[model samples]
Target: MTEGRDDRGVAQTGSNARKVFIKTYGCQMNVYDSQRMGDALGSDGYQPTETMEDADLILLNTCHIREKAAEKIYSELGRIRLLKAERANEGRELRVGVAGCVAQAEGHEIIARAPAVDLVIGPQTYHRLPQALAKVARGERVVDIDHAVEDKFDHLPASQAGQIRGRGVAAFLTVQEGCDKFCTFCVVPYTRGAEVSRPLAQILEEARRLVAAGVREITLLGQNVNAWESSDAQGRAIGLGGLVRQLAEIPNLLRLRYTTSHPRDMDDALIAAHRDLPALMPYLHLPVQSGSDRILKAMNRRHTAADYLRLLDRIRAARPDIALSGDFIVGFPGETDADFEDTLTLIREVGYASAFSFKYSPRPGTPGATMEGHVDEGVKDERLQHLQALLRDQQAAFARAQVGRRMPVLIEKHGRHPGQMIGRSPFLIPVVLPASAGAIGAVAEVRIESVRPNSLMAEGAEAMPEAMRLRA
Candidate 1:
């Protein structure tokens, strides 16, 4: 998994006495949470640092979705413990903390295993970071994992305009949290709690604030994002479709997107939004863990392989040019060779633009861990290889299809070489081209010259009325 960091480079530590280095893991939600945690700590005069050696405090905002996640955290803590001792020998001070799902699940175990850790705060209590740090300042070791009653957003301080500007033009705004669907193979329900959607007005206020700070693109984030629901001022019920429509009205907001939707929540109104809204990008990440109905039932996904295919049919019908992405898990408990073949069949039928495939690793407290017919590790490895090879081929085909097409690219940052810039296409593919620094933060039309494994090579767009007419 890629680590998330503040777009602004190493912050100057002269103004803020205390400096924090936060290492973020897991999903976009964790990335959003880390930024808010930084904002919360800012109230106590703490600035962000890129290097941990220059920090007074270090926090690990972790995820429990992957296999052996706790073990990895413990290993990192061991390294940090040695650093803490080294700082003490030099007559300096350092403090360590753990946050996010791993903290929510492991709690005191992290402190017991890594005595050097001074504080452990769960995702729910991150808004109380200032108080937690104050407690730690008094020579206290603190662990607060209780689910907070108040909305964390209500307590967290608004981010400063300077900080937002430092983060570049794209940002993530979380509109929903947690998951109500208790998929047996997952831990999100236990770690993030039940599903909760923020109030519509509260979301609008945050969107306006982000736009006012020079953010041009925003992607709404959640565990099951499409499941978001709230009410308007007229007391009319609204789902994600209505929310996207309202957000599109924000001035200067050029692009909009959301992620990690569920097939069960792909309502008609939400599909219509895809058809009607030009601001909403034509890309979707809908996960269907397995294609076999029996395996899906065992995983408690509720929707069958056929149901997922039909859902895609409707989604494609609404927006024919849409790019499709999905998630898959190989060697699920009780999955037979026939079941695996079924998955391959479904993949062939849908032809994904890109996909994330994984070998199932059962969490300790999850029901799948205790299920019968557990596939051998070797079998899992072999199956995962077969699945990934197919996915890579499909992804390459998708990239090849984009060659010679002209699309609007959002210039995000400078490239590795001089006189070049990098940006993201509407489908989230990175595009690199020769350009001046002045192009940063401006959307520019570019023609795809070639394709790379993970990105597209592009040049300044030419006068091609045909390409412009076909671009969506």
Candidate 2:
């Protein structure tokens, strides 16, 4: 773990500057938020430390998606109590704070349950962290759960604003935040608040920064990425498709992608982007959640099975080579045998290259959690296993089809096996090849030799001399 200490509004003694540690709980958005928090505090002279034991301030960046995410955070706080006590015995002050979804969900209750916690700030209120920390230093307990309507990105710097410590071939750029869809089983609308997007100029600026920093691929991120809408600084409207077109113009950017789109938001412009932008990866992760119209209506997903199928047709028509990925919930409230079969039928129709399926786990305060007719645990487990097996078979078939074909892979890092390197194809398929250490972060043309259950084994093609040239 890396360790560093700095001063934020506190007197800087050469050896006693305070260190801040943030432990993130769930989702890519939370991971991004944690990084932003680190950058924000870094500007105020606070450095990030990986471990809690050696930090003056410890913050838990939480998630409330899973059933026991809050309880898990509380348990971790309990463990940290002893560390705080030990530090206090040594005449040192250690402050603990809670941030993110659980902080938004539980509010001051987290402070009540864990009295050692000096600050509790929600995801939307992260911009006020410096003020909260200042109050904590004065022996005051602080809680901020207010959600603002304006852009939070304005208060913070660019997502990539900091010293570049390392390089990667791919990066995730957040173009939007929050969701308004409010799927009954989802807690995002409540935890993350309403939908909001950054201005087009800011997004383009961030993309250019990442490209300058050596990123070859960028995946635009949001809870409902396809629902993205924003204007430029001049008040010109821009959607996800417009954003893609602008980003594709950046020199040296080889690929683009987006994720977790709503079926209702799959418009003509976005489909056109898929057809027009050659650098856009030939893959889509459109999460339908359930195939039964009854279940879909009950979950407030708004789109029907027929609607999803029609959208799928549009996507495939735009890019026939595109591989599909999806999400499913097996036992949503009031779901029956017919409903589960409907989902199975949809899966077979879509033939997903990969998928994520989970049994319905009710989240507190969500509409579905309070609904009646919860499926039996035994039935839910059985359906989950069956769905997973079918998905595995489909993915295996997709991988096998890749054999004897050539793909462009962006090598990311060295694999655990000696002389082996790992990379991902444009469709996000993992490729393992034997290459030199210097090949990391370079694109190579590999001929598929064999297909495993989840990945492909390949070698550099001799026909393409460029494929064999390892970068130094």
Candidate 3:
């Protein structure tokens, strides 16, 4: 049972339930982790609160994927520090904690730097958050970053049924965690540890619970999501493709998707699943960090530009309407004008529906950091602008092409206007149309009427008949 709040909407101090405010940073996986952390703390009489000011404990679930993301955590801590002090002055107790990759990477340093942080728990050890909080209650600062011996997932309690329904129709379920590839410019392998796939039974159990809670869509998540592999009930080994096929069997699961794939892990069985699974969305986010062979070699991606293109060719052949997305990095060490052009050439060749491009920043302890002939910031900036402009054009073109097409859209939430509602297309594009609040969790077919800068406009299908819509 949840604790009662006062008429002013603030949690009462005398209430048995303590409120926790979690600020999640980076990735769908972090979102999943935050929810699990809440579940873990739920056992200790804590409930979630949106407003940090009313929180008895505040957690910053951080990401250390990039240098900027890591530094941003510290910047946020500075603001939280003031809030903690203010709450203390009022004689109200407020505890601050940091969790996730940044905590794993620099555990001791974070506690030393931010005196306000009472507990620091890493991604692998967050299942022990209740125990860590106990230590903090004894007037001790706690740092738990060790790769625990027991499986964290096995220890985590299932989210309360009400909590699951409150998360909305679309949800993220982490089937895998960590990385083993160890790319030169990456920190995931170090911070998240080696690759590990959750047992198939555990995943199915969770997926079933999600569906039971009215979740219509589930995006399987991981550091390298496509790399997930586990054995079936008969003890037969299966990969992500097999997992998707199994998940599609769950009744009322209208949409299935996974993200942040590695090029090397795009096996033939997974491609076949794309062709066969109707519930799987026609979108993929596979990161091919660079197009130049030299840069790819230096980065230890182990796959060349041609190899990536060939893989895409096979994938596109399997699912003709699949919208392609990729990740690109500009100005890696020793990258030249020709190397940058090669990236542009590849981008044009693939014609990405959408992509993420960044000016490369060196991460400490990664091989690329100490590599020779790092490009100038001015050049990185120039190349990034050029790449982004191209990607924007492609995205705009893709949006334009979708105009006049009829497609199924999963109504996610109510839009800004009273009658307006937003839904996600099969290609993962946001489509806004007039819809009733009752239609929020239904999948309706709508004709794309026009294109907005960031979303598609739909019409002529608002009054969806009971038979036409799949209600959650």
Candidate 4:
């Protein structure tokens, strides 16, 4: 085992602490991972820096989901090399590293291609970063790609910052890591390893701490959130609903939500949470990927269009006002016009509030990458446009419906305009209103005056209705 360590200099203390700049790319999961990495490094006496030029260490946290994500990382490395050279000319040593999925996917190839990088650690191995840095200090180019089982969360220090971006009303709390679904088009299972969940007690503790820190709304994060299962202290298995119910008991925690769930994992407990827990927000982001049964089967998604529709029906039955979001892939391998139509039909039936639609791009080491009958790029682009058009229409309709409705908006921060504060409604709609900076972190009743394509124009109230106010 190579003990990862930074040989550049001894750990700093007090005002002389070394600065580390972590540049993160890709999903919300990466954001959470970067925060944990920051927490771990902070424990090791490495304070964060905002600018690369002023940092002693630079970590590039990457994503490998898209086709050119690795290439983009290489491009960034080239730019960083110039800065490293400049520092070397000034008799200073700067440690550069790459972390996250790209590091896991490329491994030593990254070091070979980018010699300026002192360390390369994968997402699974971030817990070993301090040791990796020590190896770097010893003049060894370190690469830690071990997919071993370890609780990286245990190494993280408690979060010291409050109201990220000074928007104190909401925060994202990661309760789970990795995925097991193994969707053929996704690289998550390979990069993030197995479906490992944090213990319920740990999550609850973190949730309580977040709420105490002025976080009113918490979005529970996971690659497949609804698939969450952890044993209690007495070793009894509990699922997501139980977790939501437990977190709801936290005083001052006004709203709860989770995301990026699978259609197959839409279990009874999660649906019941929507019905029984008033704190749980009435919105669900379920990624169906594709609608055609054949394409879904090829993608190894295992759920048919009908299965997804049934799940949607159950969810709506639980919360009639629940707004829905989804993921769609256009022009997947072996997909026909009929398959594309099936996706459009599914979207129409679900009447999604919003959706993310993308053209299929093969990722290396994934099952879909080797599949035959790849669709033409032009065809994929055409289908993607068609899908987006329909989604835009539906989203506009949903936004329009919110007009004149009173929604509780948790004031996050000042908007682009002066005297305007922006926040999110329980449905996660961005609402901008004319209000004072003092309103930040407090929930205010906002009447939706008008709807833009992406945001809502709202007005703050002198007094709000009790029913519209969210209570913990």
TM-score winner: 3
Q: List the candidates ranked by TM-score, beginning with the highest.
A: 3, 1, 4, 2
* Per-residue accuracy of model 4 over 1-472 as CA lDDT, tens digit each: 1122234545544555678899999888888778778877765667777899988899999999877999999999999999999999999989999999999999999999997899999887887887788777788999997777566656555665542333266878887778888888999999888887877888888788777777889889988888889987788899998889889989899899998798888889889989999899998999998889999999999889999998888989999999999999998889999999999898888898988888899998889899999999999999999999999999999999999998888888877644567888878888877675247778887689887667887855212345433320
| Candidate 4: segments with Cα more than 4 A from true spot | 1-15, 161-167, 436-438, 460-472
Per-residue lDDT tens digits for candidate 1, residues 259-331, read 9899999999999999999889998999999989999999999999999999999999999989999999999
lDDT of 2: 0.83
| Candidate structures ordered by lDDT, highest first | 3, 1, 4, 2
lDDT of 4 at 48: 79
Highest lDDT among the candidates is held by which one?
Answer: 3
What lDDT score is found at residue 60 in candidate 4? 94
Give the Cα lDDT of each candidate: 0.87, 0.83, 0.89, 0.84
Candidate 1 stretches greater than 4 Å from native: 1-16, 436-438, 460-472
- Output the lDDT of residue 447, model 4: 83
